[model samples]
Target chain A: MGAVTTPKQDRSRATRQRLLESAVACLAEHGWAGSTVTVVAEHAGVSRGAAQHHFPTREDLFTGAVEYVAEERSAALRALPVQGRTAVVAALVDLYTGPLFRAALQLWVAASNEAQLRPRVTELEARVGRETHRIAVELLRADETRPGVRETVQGLLDMARGLGLANVLTDDTARRRRVVAQWARLLDEALG
Target chain B: MGAVTTPKQDRSRATRQRLLESAVACLAEHGWAGSTVTVVAEHAGVSRGAAQHHFPTREDLFTGAVEYVAEERSAALRALPVQGRTAVVAALVDLYTGPLFRAALQLWVAASNEAQLRPRVTELEARVGRETHRIAVELLRADETRPGVRETVQGLLDMARGLGLANVLTDDTARRRRVVAQWARLLDEALG
Candidate 1:
């Protein structure tokens, strides 16, 4: 039988979801140093106690936030239309240029130095990386067994990420459109 | 005669140099949070007062570190043999995968969130980015007058950065070699 949710339980779940979303947004804007639990709680419009109840520590909150957004992004990727290479490439590139990526970037920078947060971020990033690669393979219909095909697809994702990095300081849209177009052409040739 | 340096002046100059190098190394290893002036001074084997003397604030120390290494990297890039596209691509990619890049990445992550540090880092990054682009053009012999050539060069640099980010988690050496090779081929065709 399908499980039924009570009103109180549904409300609690919604609050938790809001907190997670709010935390990601906070991390994206504030980095680890500035994104405190109280601040995130305030941003979420939830009490500090409620945030603490959901996430016992700062590490749990940020890591949980990244994982939540990553799952949401994966779902979004899965739901994308089966458009051709150009559209698929643009979608993948968009993944890195968005708030989720910004949040994850902050987490990565923090985890690189924070001993306590390192392993969790490492594992989360690996899982997210693998998921994105797998999706790219499926979406592009790439057979990794073929010579250079895996690298080509992987290269496309890396190039997208590089574009995202370039966009961090300035709007790289004009150059990015040209780059994306060229990558689409490259992917068409290389993937085939 | 050129002005002769006294022993005290020479020692002070060496101390300042040591502090700058140590600051970069510390930022690369420990990142922004753990990289205090006292820590950098200890790493450089200088007194805290001496470190403070060289850089009056944390902002000064880290910014000076990035600037110092950037100058060094620019000189090194300039001295590279006008190798063919493949070797030049490999060398360019190597720039992102090195310690200097690691240090710069940390600084960027910090600057993205820290209001006080943002403007300086943004200016430094822009200068470095432009310098690298100019060098890449000169090395590749790609005339920017031709359309898509600029984006091609920029794409390669972005891919190199993505590869650098990938390597942050694990050794992406084998995959990167293949990607770099493919990029060299792409560059050959696109540049022509």
Candidate 2:
């Protein structure tokens, strides 16, 4: 009985998971103005009532959604197999080019101009930013104790985000590949 | 009278300019949902009818506004004096940190999800992107004809945008300065 859940509880858990995933997807595909709770509920294959049960208001839903995306990204990062620098850089860059990044971007834009959503996203950002930085340091085997090294690692991350931003409006593939490959070499020189 | 504007035409031009500037400011301060034609009209000290006369619809206002921003930014970039690499990098990064960047960012997020606004922003982005790249090439004294040199320069611009994204919600001054400085050193190594 220690880890067992009743069927009723299991069903409830599934519904909540679906809601969170669908909310982010909806937000990514449709801006905040177009993505409504009902839209999300329909996307999740759950009733609006059930979605409301998990998150009462739009703010509650987005707050939960952002946390979920962060957890998923961190998990994805940790699961990356230890690899060569080029492969690792490519993988890290991939993190910012996907749907999760798009969803987070929407939230960031929303948070910037949204008063009610600002504090929560800001708090989440600080936490997530620190966590990602620590993970990057680990993955890069970056010894930030060395002068200029910390900023180098951060510069790499910022470049990754910049590449991601470039991709937002159009397919930044061919050019992005060049930039990514070039960054791997830079990482070698700068990290050393 | 060869190049001079008539008084009535000058007033109309001023009102149009005011509307464009106000729309961007409103978009930056308040997300797309909160920023309305009426709101921008109020901010610009123009009557709603006057704003409507200049911009028939919300899309018209945003399209015109985004163009105005791109022109302003390009003009600002052209006005920068030839400077040291660090100063050049810092100035380029500054272009992405201020209100114009904020306004453009909101439009990007909105356009990503709003199909109606997509093509126009995409067109403007490509135009503005190419122009900025050309300016950066000249300012950096970057010889892109060299292998990998083009990507190196592009990387610097993307890094600047990424730093701007990081600054959207919080003041990223301290870390940003470090990243910008580090890129200056990286440029010296990579470009050479």
Candidate 3:
């Protein structure tokens, strides 16, 4: 009985994971408008009924996908090699400017006017924000207990997100590189 | 000829201005999905034909609205009272976290997935970005000739935009104030 139930659970989890990844891809490529249940199911090679079974509504699907990607991103951040401040900052910039950020931006815009999606998005953003801040604080070796240190950390995160927004609309790589370098310098000066 | 056409031209300009303002209001309140031409025209108290005559297309309407709002915001920035560094920073934060930023965030998200809208949004953003940077540099009286000075200006703008993004999803007023203050302190130290 245990073996049979475990295999079934594993298959169900795999299907759900595939659906979530497909949802993220749809979001990144097509934005909120194009990320439909039918499309996601097709992309995931799952039946519409199966997708519905996993996610009852579009909001549920989107929220699940966002949380899924955030967890993946957080795990990836934690796995990043311990490097110099410049390298770490560059890595963080790359993460923020990538597809995950794009997907999240789409949701952010949708949630701006959507009453139902707002709470979910806000909660997810706060959770992700805290995790990312934690990782960044560790990487920068900043003393969070200091008076201005936490704000500096938050400021850096804000700056990175803003740079990512610019990158979404324009080829902001050069400017982003320079900004990351400057911020690294500032962080070093403040933390030291 | 000048006198005779002036009144008619003025009327047309007023109608167009009303439509653009309505469009911005629609974007800020309703997000991209609800900001249809019909809704904007209704919001502006203009006929559908008249709205179409003024904007030609939905993209035109949105692009026009964004540009109109950017110009208005730029004017407001230019008119801000010159005060101490903290005051100026506070003003900058207010501008970024205001309705214009919310409206622009919607456009940014839409433009990310919209090929035709991307160029227009990107160009408008660059123009607005430059103007904001110029105003900030003047307000701070920072030496643009220095190597890191320009980056600092860019970084502050980026941080403000990032904070605005956060504010969109969450009630981040307290944290935003602190981040702005910390960044201002850092700027004063570097520029002084």
- What is candidate 2's lDDT per residue for A28-141, written digit by digit as tens? 899677778999999999999999999999999988999999999889988888888888888888999988999999998999977888999999988988888888888888
Q: Give the interface-residue alpha carbon RMSD of model 2.
A: 0.9
Per-candidate TM-score against the hidden true structure = 0.94, 0.97, 0.95
Docking class of 2: high
DockQ of each: 0.65, 0.85, 0.81
Q: Summarize candidate 3's per-residue lDDT along B2-121 as a digit string, tens digits.
A: 656778799998999999999999999998878999999999999999999999999999999999889988898899887999888888888878788899888888888889898899
What TM-score does chain B of candidate 1 reach? 0.96
**Model 1 reproduced share of reference interface contacts:** 0.55
Candidate 3 — which residues are off by over 4 angstroms? A1-5, B1-6
Model 1, B19-107: lDDT tens digits are 99998899888889889999999999999998898899999998899898889878888999978999999999988887888888888
Candidate 1 chain A, poorest ten consecutive residues by summed lDDT: A163-172
Give lDDT tens digits, candidate 1, residues A1-192. 428988988988999899999999998898888899999999999999999999999888888898898898899889888989888998889888888888888888788788898889888878988998999899988889987787788888889888887777667788788888877876787777
Residue lDDT tens for model 3, A72-135 = 8898889998888778878887887888888888888888888999999988988999999999
Off by over 4 Å in 1: B1-3
Ranking by lDDT: 2, 3, 1
